[model samples]
Target chain A: MRRILPWLTPLVLGALFLASGQQEVIIKVMGGAQKPALAVPDFRGGGDAAQHTGVFNETLYTDLDESGLFTMVAKSMFPLAVPQRPEDFRAPLPPPPRRKDAQPQRQGPWLTDWSAPPANASHLAFGYLAVQNEQLVLFGWLFDVTQQDVSNAQLFGKRYFGPLSADGARKVAHEFASDIIVQFGGAPLTASKIYFISDRTGFKEVWSMNPDGSEQKQLTNYRSICTTPAVSADGTRLAFTTYARVNPMIFIHSLETGRRLPFYNQVASMNATPAFTPDGRQVLYASTASGYAQIYIANADGSGVRRLSNVRAIEVEPKVSPKGGEVVFVSGRSGPQQIYKMNLDGANVERLTTGEGEASNPAWHPSGEVIAFAWTRGFEPGNWNLFLMDVASRRVDQLTHGAGRNENPSWAPDGRHLAFSSNRSGSSQIWTMLADGTKLRRLTSQGRNEKPVWGK
Target chain B: MLTKKYVAALLLSFAILFAAGCKKKAPAPPPPPPPPPAEAPAPKPNPPMITLFAAEPGTIERGQSSTLKWAVEGADDITIEPGIGRVSANGSRQVFPSSTTTYTLIARGPGGEARRTATVNVTAPPPPPPPPAPKATFEERLAREVQDAFFDYDKSNIRDDARATLTRNADALKAIFRDFPDRSVSVEGHCDERGSAEYNLGLGDRRATSAKEFLVQLGVPADKLRTISYGKERPQCTESNESCWQRNRRAHFAPGQ
Candidate 1:
């Protein structure tokens, strides 16, 4: 196994760099007995990588909660020990190593205890990376907290020929993680694409392609803010929020028609974040009609007007199950954004995400078992991360290496993969990855794409 | 080396099965619902009126509402009602006055308004349903529900509802005979919107069969009335309502057409 690390290290690094920086998560577990499982990605890293002697610790937690595989716990419910901000978190310039390393760099503040995590999380997979001698090195370990032992660990370090940027260096780390995921017999990831919005086209509009940065195309040409793009269960009809001369309203475009229809008029209010229900019979959308963002349901024809949530809260990104029986949305009822769910008739409201940094833009699986959402690190701007939660087991899995701003996750019709937008590769672009955060790929190569919605 | 490995891995990931998941959104199981209780006397007949909503034209003076009018002519007590502000009918013109109005008009009265103001634009009113045609009463609903012959799913066996339609047909049959004496009456049966159109047509025929058998049982002679099925093509309600479907799920009665 140790001998194979050197040979596999270069392949892992190459895979990471080629992933196109659309999504920096989707790491798999290489060489494992559990059928090659992948970890949940949470892409939320920030700051210069040179600070911690090039060491970046990224954790990819495999969630068996959804899919009836195992129980899951929401990471928001996990007792996380917050880190105190250093007066200067930036890494100080290092002295010449030739000069006896001059003054040794001060040790960074230690990460607090993760000893006893939230309920229902029995296993945790963690990864760490560092750049030594300008060569990237990675090590990963999955911990079974119940047993208080390392369930899995491996070291992978390699050098990349040609000039590679820090983005390429981080991607090398992600591939190593995905390797472990496949060893556990989980579904192989790698076929997905994220659609998001960016101002690269000189205006905020929607663009998309593949998660590995290919086949990029602009879906909307509106000069105004065309933010929300909701994909249908079959991945054909895209319901998105468009702002015309009137207030921001929702609309749908048929991939076959290339024709845009007025989905529903929000009547002078900002109607945005069109999420399709599982049955494709209705769209759960958000509007500013209630003085703030609130969830509302409109028939596929946009006729029926029923409010799904009514409270002093900002509820946006209403995603419904394929059966159209239940809906999960982001609620700001608890001061910060959190994930919550209620039935189609607005009964049995349950809070699933709490205490996480501004949970938003949740996308549900077609099977109605899992939900992927964008999370922010507390008090940090531009630290959007991705997280997953299983419905049955209530287990939370973090899928990213905390790389850069990643948000707006959209799942494909089959629910085995997700697409999201990220700025980790410098400019914002759409990315795709397997549902478990493996086989990371970039679907958009040019322009800025955000808020991807898979087709019907 | 790094680029090659990422390239190779991306290709290998494709070599495996493309990511796919369970295609599950099962249709909801048919729930055991409470059978409607006697259909509740078919409710009072709703007065038909040319109710219209106004669409705004262009920008008018801010804080100034436009006037919209309507005219109804169905019932006697002509009480003109406006959704926002009250309007009166003077010389057949109902004027709606409001400040800062969107020019929206909602009218309710015995006689519906011919002209409706949608915003600041003048709209040529929707043509009213040409003078009131005779409304089918509860007796018509009851008569429509009665079938000449009702049959099992795939069988043309006569059922209970067919007996009821035939019993009612006995009186109507006597009246027809008194008018023409020698003329024969043909019974047409209609099936509800439950089965396929073609299948319902056959079911309708079965209903007609049951009704004809009852007529035969009534000693009305066999060669007089023939039976036919229209199937579920005609619906009582287009909206998604079980009550409407159930109402539609019956054998309709027709003398000829």
Candidate 2:
């Protein structure tokens, strides 16, 4: 019996270890239990090549870090020497023999050599930038270190060649980061252009910029108030509200042809907040053509406009779900402004937010799991902050802590990040952050920027 | 048979009574001369007056001008309504009324206020229908005849005050059509910046169409009026107050071909 007991104990310990290991594997496969730790080392370059290297490395790191799907390992915690080439990466070495009388030490680098896997990093992204023929070329690679077999290391690799300009540097980094995201079976943020309203040119006009806030170009020179920009699904046409004469009118500008025309120039009513359906066949917007603000669905060319919402309150800022099955909008039917959801046919009306100062600009996450909106608890000016509510559970989570008025939360196409307008820096500007409300980054610095809408 | 002392007392009482009667009969010392009749108070002047209020020529052509003259007495302030603002107590103003309009002059004084009105009649003689001019130089004249129609806050329905203005506008439009059959009028809708720009666009459209419909109902050809909505984009007044917004929320008329 004693002899059998010793054997049974070892068997029990072995089974327990195998069970825990399997559980971890299952969690990793699901990719929902905990964020995967990612290590982004500085890209290798020297001299003139280093000009874009720093920006490229930082932008890639920021892009992944703000994805909300990764926990970025700090650069300080990396090895003393980073290996930028894929061939330079090596697996951790075996631990040395320990004496019974001595205390046990850590298994890797701290105890032995520096050739070891990073601590708690399941993924590693490393790259190098070089100036080749007057162009900045980026060669990036991502590795999944979670596997025990180091021989099967390559997850994805990308090569980007562009002009040696600042915008080129950001684009290279963004493109490589998008490749890495796609490798993980996630939707890439397709909205490379963010259309916003800026008052930099003396009057509020429609302005657009790269997602990284570079190459900002004014799209309209109306010299009057222009706002509420809506980009078509194909990113070809931009529809916005402009005051060309004495009243606001919806005007569409073709990005390719550079021609502008009025979509609806009815003389007495207001039409604003236009959103194209996923199929790009129709545009849903808010209009007061019926004597009160109501949601209206119209053809792409402003024909066949019909009311979509029947409630006798101000219904504006309509956003159709990614699947085009439902819509969420801002309504004042219950007195104070609140966000509500309804079927695409305007049936099964349900209020999504209640008991607040005011809530507006409800943005549907691309995953269709959550909705983010701007909420204020009181009537105080600059009290608006962002809040995300789970569509099914109705659990509300505040995303901003009143740094300044944070309103107009727009979800990144990835469904893991958001771009919003905040006056936190004294003047309203466009800002971006992860979906979990971390890593706040300012995207605009000039002029008063508001109503940032990320294009699909 | 009475005693001698009693007879003497009775005779003395008789003599006293006879003396009192003689005094009474003598007119009681001529009583006191009658007092003079009470004098009446002098009369007070009437309150400040507007002695004269007149509009010279009284009646003129639709585009012709007239002078408004007024005289006021004992006034600290005076004003004339219908766009002739504050003025001196005794003054004259030359006014051009597109339609028959009554200008009221109000003179305020310490005693009270006196008001007088002078109406200038604008007459458009019905003429034999004229032939259409393809390249006429009446563009500016036609532009002046098309009047703006106003609306209330967040409302597209024409107000009661706007009806009179619209009637005049309709009459002028009818006359224009009778002479120039090819010209058309465009009614532009506008709104105050009190609501969302998109919603205001719809509201402005309704307002422009409402004005156009009214003109059509008043005998103007339906095809003569075209509608466009500006939706609070072009505010007549840039101020953020209600007064400015009221002016912005209107339907403006522009002569179109």
Candidate 3:
């Protein structure tokens, strides 16, 4: 086996290059409790394409590394030999069964063994890039190197064609990483955007950026305080609260036309935190139209308003479940603020959080099995931290430590990550983290960003 | 004739006697006039006297100005109630009252004290039926009548102080509804900067709703009041202290459409 190593490397590398261009290839391998180590090698391309390929490869590595589910193996530990083509190497089949009673089985060739000890990487991802007609053509492939069957070892492969630009490289990389994540039975979050409030322009306004904190752009310029932004499922409309008038009123902004229309124009009354129902046909918000802050539901256009909660206590920060069966909100009906869930019609209200301290800003996860909210211990003096509660079990897990005040937890479409605002960096800004409070990354650094809502 | 001759001598005597008696009766007519009474000593005058107190143009419309003029004799200090403090012993002040008001003037001195009152009858045109009371606009109500009810940190239940404020607010709302039957009241809930905006909104909402509910129980029509949670968005104080946060975590009342 040691003598065959030099020849085996080239053959395996060649096979990966040949397999890269194929579209929609999927393979699976047995997984374990520990994070699988992954190897991301540089793509095979030359000239201007080489630079683009480097960018793509680096981005893919970063994405996977930031996911907190994979351990990247460095290239320095790779084998000395390199294969440039598919014909340069070939794998050997396993030996036949020794017992005569054993049925004859088909055997598939496996790639060179790199899944053990020092360079123990269970999977490998590599691809090729080409510049053709001023367009970038990218080929990406993921292999389960731990698998013995070569045919089954190919996890996934995808080809992307886009403009030959840096942004194009990022797009291709993100798409490929999304494919890889999906192959691992995890939801892909790369395509989503985050909507949050920023005071960068001297006034708090609604703004949005990619999940990776790229392409940040202001969405509303009311020149006043705009906050609590909620994006529609289709990403065409944004619902937010603005103080352009005497009182804070809900407004719906059309992303396509860049026009904003007042959703609730009742003078001297507050209407805020407009969350769209799963179907986007209705909106659930906190309104003082009844002379108290209670959950109210209205048509998406702000018509046909009706009060939803009648607890006579303060009910606000309402979020409709993804399934549209119930609404979770922060209520003070039982004394200190606590998260409560009620049916769409406000029936069968049940408290979701208890014990010392206050719980608020309840956001139902898209998966509909858990809720994320902000909690602070009753006797604590610092800021609120994030917490997740299983809806069924009522078990709670703290997501953020007391690293500045972390609150306003909004779940990404994938349900595995959340975007929240924290003042840990000296000022309140938007930050993202995994569901279990890992992989904390800052998303905004400018003036007092907050109330981040992840877009679908 | 012989009898008359004989009687003449007697008559002459009788006539002489009657003339004498008539002469004596004339002197008795001047009987003594009534005697003059004895002279009495002069009495002493009282001191610290508010000799004159008057309100010029006493009959004026509501909110119209009236001048309270007063004159005091031998007084060290003079003051009036319902807002005016110590003033000159003899002075006048321009006053504006929303309704008919009676101003009392008190003058104090070594000799003693004196009191006088001048009534300014606010004489606006006859109010319409149902006794058209002075109606306060929404803004005016918010500034004048509606009280801000505050709460403890992280708590939304009405505090004792908050209850006092809500009681006054409820009374004001009742009067407002009486005068402007169609108008409604809105309670705005607010929070301090200590908590998250999302959570604060809920907290503020609870505060506002708690206040409104108290008002309802106090006879402010439930339908006449509404509630909104501004959360921490509209803070009354920006400082990072308990005082500021206490002010921020309050329910402010205002007139609504």
RMSD of each: 43.6, 26.2, 18.8
Local accuracy of candidate 1 as per-residue lDDT tens digits, A1-456 = 999999999999988875653322222211112331222223232233334323222312322322212334455654433222222122324665788649635334111123343334444444434444564544444444344222222222222221134555445544544544344433423244445666678766766554445456677788865666666666567777664443357878875576786565666335666776766777877765655557888888688878888886556677787656878877757755568889988899888876656666677765567777877645353366887776555555667767766777777644566777776887666776666666566666556555666643
Quality of candidate 1's docking, in CAPRI categories? incorrect
Ranking under lDDT, best-scoring first? 3, 2, 1
Task: State the lDDT of candidate 3 residue by residue for A180-258, as single tens digits.
Answer: 8777676677878899999999988989898889889998888988988888878888998887774678889987788
* TM-score result, candidate 2: 0.60
TM-score of each: 0.39, 0.60, 0.65
lDDT of 1 by residue, B1-257 (tens): 89999999999887664543344447777879998867556455345353434333233443343434444333333343344454443223323333333433344444433434444533444576798887654345335543433444433445566566567767666655555555554455454433322223334444555566677777766776655444443456644355655555444455432
Q: Which 10 consecutive residues of model 1 chain A have the lowest summed lDDT? A: A24-33
Ranking by DockQ: 3, 2, 1
lDDT for each candidate structure: 0.54, 0.76, 0.78
Model 2 has an lDDT value of: 0.76
Question: Which candidate number would show the highest lDDT if scored against the true structure?
Answer: 3
Give candidate 2 misplaced runs (Cα > 4 Å).
Answer: A1-33, A46-48, A90-118, A131-135, A163-168, A261-268, A379-382, B1-257
Per-residue lDDT over B1-257 for candidate 2, one digit per residue giving the tens place of the 0 to 100 score: 56998999999999999988776543344578899978978655456699989999899888789999988998888899989889987888899999999999988887688888999999995686888776544566566776678898656778887898899988988988888788777788888754444445656777888898888899899988877676755678866577887889899887763
